[model samples]
Target chain A: MDAPAIYRIALDVMGGDNAPVALLEGARAALQAHPELFLHLVGDEDRLRPLLAHTGLKGELASRFAIVHAASVVDMDDKATSILKEKKDSSIRVAAQLVREGKADGVVSMGHTGAAMVASKMVLGTLSGVDRPCLAAILPNMQGRPTVLLDVGANIDCRPDQIAQFAIMGSIYAEGVLGIPGPRVGVLSVGEEEGKGSTTTREAAEALKDIDLNFAGNAEGRDIWNGKFDVIACDGFVGNALLKSAEALAEGLVQGMKGVFKENLLTKLAALLTLNGLKRFAARLDYAEYGGAPLLGVKGVSIIGHGRSNAKAVHSAIRAALMASEHRVNDQIQASLGRLMSQAGSQETS
Target chain B: MDAPAIYRIALDVMGGDNAPVALLEGARAALQAHPELFLHLVGDEDRLRPLLAHTGLKGELASRFAIVHAASVVDMDDKATSILKEKKDSSIRVAAQLVREGKADGVVSMGHTGAAMVASKMVLGTLSGVDRPCLAAILPNMQGRPTVLLDVGANIDCRPDQIAQFAIMGSIYAEGVLGIPGPRVGVLSVGEEEGKGSTTTREAAEALKDIDLNFAGNAEGRDIWNGKFDVIACDGFVGNALLKSAEALAEGLVQGMKGVFKENLLTKLAALLTLNGLKRFAARLDYAEYGGAPLLGVKGVSIIGHGRSNAKAVHSAIRAALMASEHRVNDQIQASLGRLMSQAGSQETS
Candidate 1:
């Protein structure tokens, strides 16, 4: 039916803990899964070329991929803005450049999150009317549908207007990409009441009311996965804490369960019986399932994954990039922001 | 052993989800567990007298407890400062007033947290140099030792000085009450690096260096339960988000496991085999085990438990209040703040 539209993604091969090997394998998996997918492998050609050879792609499939050599790699400790000046030829920068130059539809990197955000913002620029770009993470909720939580770790300190901008971007991303119709947007706070959080949060809640969205007042931290709001917007500092703590808790619980199962023969037998169910449970909480968090408000699709991302995670990230590009999320975001600005402008005149 | 010293706690029996029933049971449990404990049951005398009869505390033990009647109850939806003028006769206020009047050593309430904080601060007032009171929650970490997380929801907008003060108070609480020697204190940030967080966090980190404690630079959200630091401090907004998110995740995971076990007959049998281990796991993550969070920096002990607290949680909260009172946490906090102020004064003169 209407032959699948070709989607191209620039892959930062030399990023994340798994690096080129996991990324190369993920690229292969994505290519195998989607016939219309193409990848620009951005990394050291010497390292990637050999890895590409071992990926076992035949003539037609092999034509779907190419290596774009990058001289440097951004270290985890590198300053977020260092890629702009110091490590200009870094894989993350080169990958974003591919998107900027229209050589690829999107970019995917499981690298230094700060570096990825900086590179994407500097290279592709922000969507029209958007000030600062924010990161939006798709979390699996009890409702089985995904909830989008934004500004996970981008802008540490945000003004009321920026929080409002984040809400609009998050709503658009949720509806346009996550397919949640009329996404319910809520500002994260200490309590669900309008004036129950910090002064910034209170102002943010007020700002959110003036926006053109199905704004659901304030959401508490527990509401993140309680299947209440489709989109929850928070400042990066708070959002980052929640995201990291949730991830660590899930990981720790999984590890604790493993320890529990290994305690005795009877428990071991119980583990065997409940293996599939437990695996499904863990999968629900797994970051790899969601793949990467999209750097929203950027002019182009830029998916940033966890540093500890695996082959499966990389594959999911590429798929996310493809979906974001296909859905034209940035276009929707720009249109939404334009509408908001015009509304404010009209209100001022009145 | 030397005769146990009497520790009197003013209990807000009308607070929490379970109200009088759970509070009565908890008071009984606490009284049974601690021979020298006394409770000033603060609520409507009519409701209390009947419930206290069924508690089975008799003769000398019965004489140890007394009903301190209050006419009004603080509703969950009431304004935090309403108890100051509007609902002055509220159970929570009565409990705190008992402490202020020297009738009780501490106050315990499973009521609106903000109200409890307001009442404690207004009635007992802040310790000598503590300008604001902060909440310190004891979280069970992977290392088997408890980590103290402060400002969970007390002061939403904290200054650099206030955060530094929270660190000092948290360190004291961890050392004095939790019994950790020379508690490792940390400022909660997005990263462990000194310059990695927001302006306030960076400033707090700087302020922490001049304080007299084992300052551990910066601690991330995961560090709350990773057992990295003995005490972690953050603004109430961020800390609340982290605390609530962690609690929800642990709860959601437990529910997920229960669902998995109930899925099939085989899984049910498996659950039967691993019931004890699962219970232990759940217990480890249970808030009942920790009981309550202390409102540190106040002139007297004020413990705030969850609204959903059961008899066990209330009992634990009473025990926490007793420990806090017994250890003279306020004296230690005042001494710490006094030393810091004098140090600052000397530095200014120099």
Candidate 2:
């Protein structure tokens, strides 16, 4: 029988705090779960071969995955521009390039976020008419569904135009990739009221209202996780802060719970009973569930997973990439942008 | 025999979501716990009297508390400027005025945050030489200790100078009220590395390094709850967003837990095993543990607790107010400001 056309995902091996281990596990898990999935492990081939032998999964599945040897690895702590300048042979750069060249469907990395962003921008390039790429992540909400918060950290100083683009990109990602229907887009501001935010934010909010999407009125920081809206758009700086704060609070709650339980026997006994449910809850809150943050505005489906990601997170990130690719997220984003620009021009004429 | 001198706490009856009910219960609870603690309940007598009859604890702590009747009550959702202009008889204004006029030792309110901030500014005023007032809240760390994060939302258009003041105020508050010796202070930013944030943030970071306090340099959003630092300072806008995001995430996690447990039989079984521990954990993560956000840089102790605060949160807020009073936080802040001004002068000269 003839072999099927395999779906290939390029994995950056020399990235993240854990690096090779996370990449190896992610590739292994993906391959084990899906027989048709192929992985292009981009890193030092010599190092990967030894690790692959010990991975326990052998024969056809192991043979399906391949390593495109890259001479250099970007330092996880290096500045973005520094990594760009000196790390031409870096695994992340090569992996992103593979997607750009159409050799792979997607690029997944748990590397230095700035480095991933840099590599994605340089190799994959921005989508048509997109000035800068934005990182979009799925935040767990009161509703089991995730809220797509855009510009999580890509561009810190965003103009009103950039925010408008973010709204469009985020809407497409939520509806197309995440299976949300007609996703409601809300601009993150100081208040939900029409005119209660900074100058740029107010302009963005006004602009969003006129868009073709289901634009909800302004949403405050509290509204992001309230599950009232599906897409939360903001400047990268504010979005980054919001994303980090939410992550910290979620982890802090777990830590605080542990502290409470360890306080005394009564609380400890109570905690023991609640451990399983809490673990399940924690799992839901984990960013890994939604996979990595997709670098929206890039031509290809490029995912930047957390640098601290383990095997499970990386595996989830790969799934996210495939989902994004399958849904033609970038194409939809381009279409949305076209509609927005034409709408703006028609309004100006009128 | 003469009775002991009760520590009188002025309660703003018109402040909060469930106003009179929450105020009544909180006062009753406070008086119940500390027989020597007296509540000078300030609001319209007729409005409060009806609520008191329903509380059922009136007769129990009747002798310990007294209603210092006012003629009018402030609406919890009124505009801050409007309340400041026409509502001299407003409960929050009256409560703040009582503290300023020395008619009461300390004032507690769970009212509209803006109105509370305005009332504090108008009545108590900023500390001598302090340019603006800021709000500070204690975030629970895993070590059973609280980390002070300031500018919780008092001012939004923060200059670098204002952030420096916030840092000073937060340091003193952490050291005194929270009882941490030589509290370490960190400026909240997008990254921890030196000069890894906005222009204003970088300037503030450099400015803080010269201060006499334990300046630990810049801390990222993740480090806010990490407990590595005692006090984290930021611009009010960032602080407000961070604070609200944390609260929203905490609430979302609780809601998610409830949703999961209520999903199916297997999850329900997991929920049953985790009930006691979940409750304990929930209690620990609850914001009520720290009471309220102190309006730092003000001359007197003023705390802005949540508008939806229950009796427990309100009662804790009163205790927080008392702690601020005993710590002489305002006095230390004034001293810190003097040092800051001199540093600025020297920097300009050199």
Candidate 3:
């Protein structure tokens, strides 16, 4: 009898700050959770083999995974396209090549974000109707459901049409993987008014209005967390700044709270009592819960985790990649873009 | 005996969410704090006279203040340029006009931000050698001293030279007004690397490097709060979004903490014990404590407060205006710009 098909994911274990140890532990957790998952651990084979043995992947479970040897690792300071030339045997490059050659269904990396994006785009290529692949970060909104903010750090200077494409792809991702029906899409701007934004934002708002989706007009920066949008799209520069600023503020506030609670014996006792509640609150705001941001518009699923991702975060990233692949999000994006182009063609001719 | 020279500040009493009462109360507070301050209360005379009488400003204090009546109020939705044509008698317009006609030393408004900017630019005009006026927001950093972030909502699409001008003006403002000696100026970008930003940011960085100032190269979004930069300059759109996002995140976390504390009796007890410590933490992050942001590069000091400004915030704006006028910040800005222009001319000849 033939064996059942398995979902193969290529994870670059040599990337990120915590590196191979955290990644191997996460892989072990993922393998245990999902029996059909077969991981291609792309890194130094000798280092990974010993670590994998100690990580409790014994007996039958050991047969599910394989070590894909990679000679070098991409540095955080390396250029985005350097992996394709000088570091052709880099872990990220090898992982992307696995996806390109159909050896793996998706690629996951916690290395340099730009290098991962470049490797994904150059090796796996973008979808037929997509101009550039964008990163979609699943941020926890006030509403229980997560909001997908696209072009977080990809395509820093985007054209109007490219932004419009992000809205479409982001909507599909939210609807497909996130299970939101007919998600509300918004273009990030200074104001909610139609005419109140930069030239690119204003033009993108106009383009979004013509597309066949639940376009909710312009969303202010406050609207990002106000539960007004299921998906918010902006140029990578603005999105990156906004994301980083929010992260820094949240971290600063948490540290400030810690200092406040440690003022004296009374406050310390109060902190002890409220420790569980604060832990839950912090969990809600933690980016690790969502694992990693997905590189949308690529032909194959590519998840990019944070450099500081822990075992839980890696497990989450692997889960996200599996769900994205299972839901066929790329196909939905292609179909949506094809419809948009056809509609535009009809409008122009009419 | 002759009275000492008074510093006159035009206060727009009919603007902001808590208008009239808040503004009048603030004026009373400012008058009480500084003996040399004389406020020109710009609003309906009938309303101002009655409120002023009830706000504990009697006899001696009443003599220092004067009521300058205006018939109309600029709505929050009013076009930025509408005050020049239609809303001629608006409170904000009259306040700015008072400064233009040399009736007041500086203008303070809590009305429509765009209108305040437009009125300041059109009536008072930009200073010589400065192409555009920008808003500088004093944000609290990890360090004790606050960081000044410029162009918070002014000049969305800025040229490279205009950004360079912002860096210089920001540096001068930080040093002159904020009392930071030789303030470190940085151009806001996605990454700290020189070539990692958009075309505008790259060109602006290049321009900033040549200028005679303590240019700190590129500052990422995280650097805004990390306290590495004394003053960070960026186009209005990015700055506005970053500022708003940070504000929203902080507010959201505070509310989230409140929810966490209210979960049960134990957490509630914990919250009671830490109330004072939490209040102090909140005070540190509150925008009200900072009062208002100054519209720099204008011929005269124009301080624009938030629409939600309460009595305390209104009082702070008046105090800021008084300080800016007393310190002669505008004159210092003019002199700095002149130096920058001459340096450029000499470089060209060489």
Candidate 2 vs candidate 3, lDDT winner: 3
Candidate 1 lDDT tens digits, B1-350: 98768999999999999998999899889998987799999999987887766766465678779898899998988999999998999999999998999989999999888899999989998888997899988898877678899889887889988999999998988887778999999999998877989999999899889767999899998898889899999998888888888887778887998899999999999999998987787677776877899999887899999999999999999998888888888898888889888888998999
User: Candidate 1: where is the Cα deviation over 4 Å?
Assistant: A1-5, A77-82, B1-5
> Worst ten-residue run, lDDT, model 1 chain A?
A50-59
Among incorrect, acceptable, medium and high, the docking class of model 1 is medium
State the lDDT at B293 in candidate 2.
85
Tell how far residue B329 is off in model 2, in angstroms: 2.6
For model 2, the superposed segments whose C-alpha errors exceed 4 Å read: A1-8, A16-25, A28-38, A50-65, A75-82, A100-102, A255-283, A308-312, A338-350, B1-9, B28-39, B47-66, B85-88, B100-102, B256-286, B346-350
Q: Please state the i-RMS of candidate 1.
A: 1.1
- In candidate 3, position B177 carries an lDDT of 67
DockQ numbers for every candidate? 0.76, 0.35, 0.71
Q: Give me the candidate number with maximum DockQ.
A: 1
Give the docking tier of candidate 2: acceptable
Ranking by DockQ: 1, 3, 2
TM-score, every prediction:
0.95, 0.87, 0.95
- Count of clashing residue pairs in every prediction: 0, 5, 0
TM-score, chain B, model 3, is 0.94
